[model samples]
Target: MTQSTVPPLKVGLVGFGYASATFHAPLIAATPGLQLAAVSSSAPGRVHAAFPDAMLYATPEALYACDDIDLVVIATPNDTHFPLARAALEAGKHVVVDKPFVLDTSQARELIALADARSLRLSAFHNRRWDGDFMTLSQLLAEGTLGRIVHVESHFDRYRPQVQARWRESGAAGGGLWYDLGPHLVDQAVQLFGPPATIWLDMEQQRDGALTDDWFHAVLGYGTMRVVLHASALTAIPAPRFTVHGTQGSYVKHGLDMQETALRAGAALADGWSADTSDGVLALHTAQGVVEQAHATLPGAYTQYYAQMRDAILHGAPVPVTAESAHDVLALIEAGIASAREARVVQLRGQV
Candidate 1:
């Protein structure tokens, strides 16, 4: 059948929170081969405001019960991810859970096994993998422009001084900066260089009302290469989005991707928005001395994820973020927490 003749995959989004509304909902709606058919939200008006025609359900189970929903996207709290995903998978629907795939690797492995047994597509929304800066950095490394990478630092710092009352900050089992932001940083690192050999972590409750760790610093060691991942709610001055050093020299870039901001402001999802960042600076060590130049960042196409996900359902394409890859991310997160608690470098499983 021709592309135009193929039917769109109907997706049921299971939450209307910041992640769902700001990222998942609009991206799914804009993808050519996907439809935002139904949503489960307590506030129907919230879903209707952005998607007036979308079918609304008061509870997630109700949405999962709809046979029309070919795919279920879980955008709920960290602790709720595994249960909601299991329920959706048990309902015989393809599943997509937001980042920090699950609270632990065991949960991720269970979902992976269940999906494989049922022959269903399972994926994680590691959207930051498509960030403009990351895309550019990937290209730089691919082209050997940075020579052999030796040290890398990635930060996702924010400036929220006062902690809000939310499940994410409630000191729950899966609530903390490490679980909240570490997945993105670690996933990006694994994308550039495979899983690390060891990880050392340190976390702190820096904010006044913080019941959970609001700041975290983790180091992933790969042989001679050392990567530092950090995030904090109390950061005032901006840290480099990425600071990568190689035998050639270093690459330094600042500022977060603007796609999320644009989406929050209701910018129509389009290819034009992929150019969401400024040129990053590259420093090279030359015999003459030090040479620095501005390197153009590539456009970040987050919409590709939903488009690819649609193909995975209809055309049997590989999932945008495979379940195994997300499992690795969660494994690293668990290791980081253990490292913080034990105050030592933790060796990653199956890595010698």
Candidate 2:
């Protein structure tokens, strides 16, 4: 098919909640060659208010059955991701599942095989890969400026001291900060250093009356390298978003990505939309003394994920976040959970 003849792929979002409203919907609308054709939401008024021209379905099943939808985006809760994605793929639609792809690796593998059999594009929205700070860090690593990374620390702390009445904080399957934020950190780690050989997890319910784990500290061991992932609900002052130390130097980033804040404030997509204001500190161990310098942050492009997905469907380009890569994340998550529950270090078995 010629580029000029290819129409915009009709997209159906399966949820209109925080992830849908804040991240997926805006990014989808911003990307070219992709159309937000419909959405599945309990509150049709909310969907209509945000996207008046798009059709609204009362259930995911209805949305999956829609012949107009060429792609289905599953932005619902963590628990619903697997079934919803399966249904969409079964309906002969390309699928995109939000982060923490699914509850387990088995589910991820199933979806991957199904999508492969159907010759459809399937991806997990590991959008943090597009964060300005992370992008900068990735560049630095690729350049080998940090030189033989020995220790890496990544954090996603928050001060949600009050236990909210939500499924995330509830004592349900796929509930807790571990499952919520673990995927981002783990995926980033795996992207940088491949899979860890061993995993050690320490998870707890720190907030008062919190039924699920509100805090977790996971240690991923990659030979001599150590990657620590941490998140907490009671943290008043959070730690650095990323800290990497190597044989040659160290890099420390202070703030989280600004895209979330921008989207929350309803900022329009513009030039330099994802540029970070704060600079990361890089300290190099010179022969004479340690030389410190400020590293310019890279511009993040979350819309690139959807754009690549559009290209993959229209032009046969590679999907940005493949189901195989996301399956590795789910494997790490499962290992972490087992390590925490069994009070022992778990060895990663398969190829990541």
Computed on alpha carbons, the lDDT of every model, listed in order, comes to 0.91, 0.92
lDDT per residue as tens, model 2, 1-352: 6765678899999999889999999999998888999999998998899899999888999988888799999988789899999989999999999988999989998999999999999999999999999999999999999899999999998898899988888898899999999999999999988888999999998878999999999999988999999999988899999999998999999988999999977789999778898999999989988999999999888979999999999879999999999998988898899899999999884645
- Candidate 1 lDDT tens digits, 173-218: 8888888888899999999999899999999998887899999999
TM-score of each: 0.98, 0.97
**Colliding pairs, model 1:** none
In candidate 2, which residue ranges exceed 4 Å CA deviation? Answer: 1-5, 349-352
Residue 285 lDDT in candidate 2 = 89
* lDDT assessment of candidate 2: 0.92
| lDDT of candidate model 1 versus the reference | 0.91
> What TM-score should be assigned to candidate 2?
0.97
The regions of model 1 sitting more than 4 angstroms off are 349-352
